[model samples]
Target: MTKKTPSLISSEFFEPAKASEQVAPKETALEIVARLEKSLVGRNPANQQSPRPPTRVQIPLWSEDHRPVLHDLVRSALFTCGQRDARMDLKAKPIYALEHIKITYTGEELRQRDYDVYLQILHLSRGATVDNRQEWVEFEARSLIKMLGWTQNSRSLVELRETIRRLTACALEVTRSRTKSSVPVVYGGPLLLKYAGAQEGGFDEVTFWKVQINSEVAAQLKPGDYTRIDWQIRTKLSPLEKWLHAFYSTNQHPYPMKVETIHKLCGSRMAEIKFFRRAIKAALDRLTEVGFLSSWQLDDTDKVKVVRSQMLTIQDRESNNDVRT
Candidate 1:
């Protein structure tokens, strides 16, 4: 008897109506993770990761004469331990007075590695949250280690600090590690004012986290350091990509500009610029489909008109600068 081989089903065989089902959905869990991860890193993860919600934090509450250092530290701890994870999943509600904030995996039969990875994230988060605190700091470290199956009381402030350092760095590293398995796309910078284009509610979730995290972390720092962290967060873009994309999107370079220009203008690492491009292009495509901004090849006169309008804007800016001088 001859063995049989499986043949592929080509699109030619599918009806027009059925083509949509064949196409993969745009939004996915990975996309959510990627977006949040970018926002966290850009927003100063160390500062933004807070325990309490923003609606509750009070700012300028500290008087110049007596700045409460421990309060600042508490604010940072709460924000780091709570806020970043809090905003993503509306289903995840706050439950207080619990010893360990246990994150259970119940939806699917996820691999042990998945649990371990996320557990590591939580462990490191706890370590950072309790950084420099004499009370409950060791306990937080121990609980975090327990979750990771690493049991030994040898953890020191130095060790905890190292853990915090590694964990924050790992957030970026681990993100890259996972990206290899998925389709690679450009990441537009953080959804800041400039790059928002037609995308509404861009960075609202991130901005919400930043504002709340800053106020909370402000309460937890070591006097001078507390102010430094909070102030930096207020001034800097969390992901940095949002500002870069805003720059590119504002300039109507027909078709995407040379990828290198994007990398240079945005000051993004190679991998990040790649993703930024994908995000911008994806957003543009989406906008075009919805009849927001029309995207077309340079061959068309209408497309040339768009480019000309962009050029005029640049010239106007230059002219304004000359006039000011």
Candidate 2:
């Protein structure tokens, strides 16, 4: 036999394969897909976009127990003096007179609208600290409308401007009687100063305003001098009801007052006492219905005794059923 080198091929390849022998299987498509999915377990999709965050709406938190001190005077019709029409050189006689004190409105007699503006100004500027007599207090037009529960519209804007004009033009005079002599105090400067610049589009608008509360008037507003009127209830009340609410709120412990006394204090224009009594009774009823009064009664002595409720301090939203006209 010839001496040949051993063949590189295995003996098994040269021999016939057994029927039970098997070779390793190739990976299927499903197996490949599952392996790829497992690799991507902790990762975010490359094409996904994140959502934008929501914007917050700003709602002002108004004080429930604080209003302007001027509310005491303006709440009543005394400032208006029951004058509906504007007068030239209108000077009202002393509308209210108490022991050693007298109050008079000069220039144009204020109307209910004028007092409304004055009250809003006082309410907005309640937090201001007067460093000097000439210090100016500023407020925004948008804030004024929102606080007064007015719609922001063209007509409302015009009316707001007109209100500012009236308030700045009106003057208040107070005369005090002393043991030996009487002193006369006057507030003659403009109550407010308005500033509105032209927009880029050449449109004129009243963006905001500045006001100076008279020093004498500001003195009366020191701590413990202001009243808390329920503005939510106030906006819905008629003129008479609003006045009664303001008047009674200022008195911490109200005493029984005669109807005649209330009528005089209210400075009502009604000619007859009987008519005034009826109107006043209606207003009181409204107040009671709104939970402002525990009870009120006219005694045999013709005196009106009012039992005030602590609702303003206790309740946040009073019933408005009686306030609706």
Candidate 3:
């Protein structure tokens, strides 16, 4: 019982081309070779065109004096208050505020990275052609990743998204003192109005994101008060170092600040004063090593004395100091 294999085609008579049959044009060897080459390179020979050069991505440069414009509180630890992971809901009486200003962060405690994200947003916003009513800005994820000197990876993208979310979720109740009356005017708003990313895909698929700065927050970004930070040096420093740099950069002539004052300003949750002092000392040492600070030392009273580099001063903006660390 041998089984027969089924035939794929029916037996039929095939006719050769007749003399009257339309003859097809034959391609020359060169034409055939050219077509083959085109096909191999993923081009249609029929519609072949000259190849274009790779596009040059223009990255905006950081102006020597261009600083991130941030509200004093935002620049400080009011929003990033407490431990890196602690959820905070703080009410504090700032010197400028007539009444206690409430600050809250329910999710992961806002950290130095979150503040960096905010500053980066401001940096990007400054470059954009913004109108008076322009409350929102759209940025390509790739552009931001490149600007921040971050590795193009899923983890970085996820962290970026989370940082934006934290900014949008955090809220502040700012109290402004009125000259005419003793009444305190309270202004409350989220750091960001909205944040949106690609819905149906991964980080690679998400091309851009849109973020809206809250009106109140936007108002505080006026030119005169903004401090221009050296982001190149900033990105290289530790969290505490970066914060101290920002804090001191705002002042024209930085005075000797107490470690306790700095600890409070940094919103550190270190339970022991000794630990906080050590952290501050380490940060200052790094700053000094980086040339951002000329020199720094602790006095007998435990107050930290810091000498600002000419680069950190607006008076001598042209001075180029070596920031090695």
True-structure RMSD, every candidate: 29.4, 23.1, 20.4
Candidate lDDT (C-alpha), each: 0.29, 0.59, 0.63
Whole-model lDDT, model 2: 0.59
In candidate 2, what are the lDDT values of residues 1-325, reduced to their tens digit? 9999999988888776676775558889999898877677537565244664332222122485345434336433455335444443557556553344456666655555556677777665655555234455677776777777778776666677767776766665655433236564333333443323222221335666776655446555533434556677777667667767776676545677777767766667677989988887888899888888888998887788888785543322221111100
* Candidate 2 collision pairs: none
**Model 3: lowest-lDDT 10 consecutive positions:** 316-325
The model with the greater lDDT, 2 or 3, is 3
Tens-digit lDDT track for model 3 on 1-325? Answer: 9999976766432556676785689999999998988787675564565776433222233574355634345334653334355565444333221122233333445667777777777666664533324546789877787777778877778778877887887666655432446686455566677877764367434657888766555554443435567777887787788778876666545667667767766778788999988888888889988878888889988778778884444432432221110
Return whichever of 1 and 3 wins on TM-score.
Answer: 3
Sort order, TM-score high to low: 3, 2, 1
Q: For every model in order, what is the number of clashing pairs? A: 34, 0, 1
> In model 3, what lDDT does residue 62 have?
50
Residue 304 shift from truth in candidate 3, angstroms = 1.2
For each candidate, give its TM-score against the true structure. Answer: 0.18, 0.62, 0.65
Q: Predictions ranked by lDDT, top down? A: 3, 2, 1
For the record, the alpha-carbon RMSD of candidate 3 to the native fold, in angstroms, is 20.4
The prediction achieving the highest lDDT against the true structure is 3
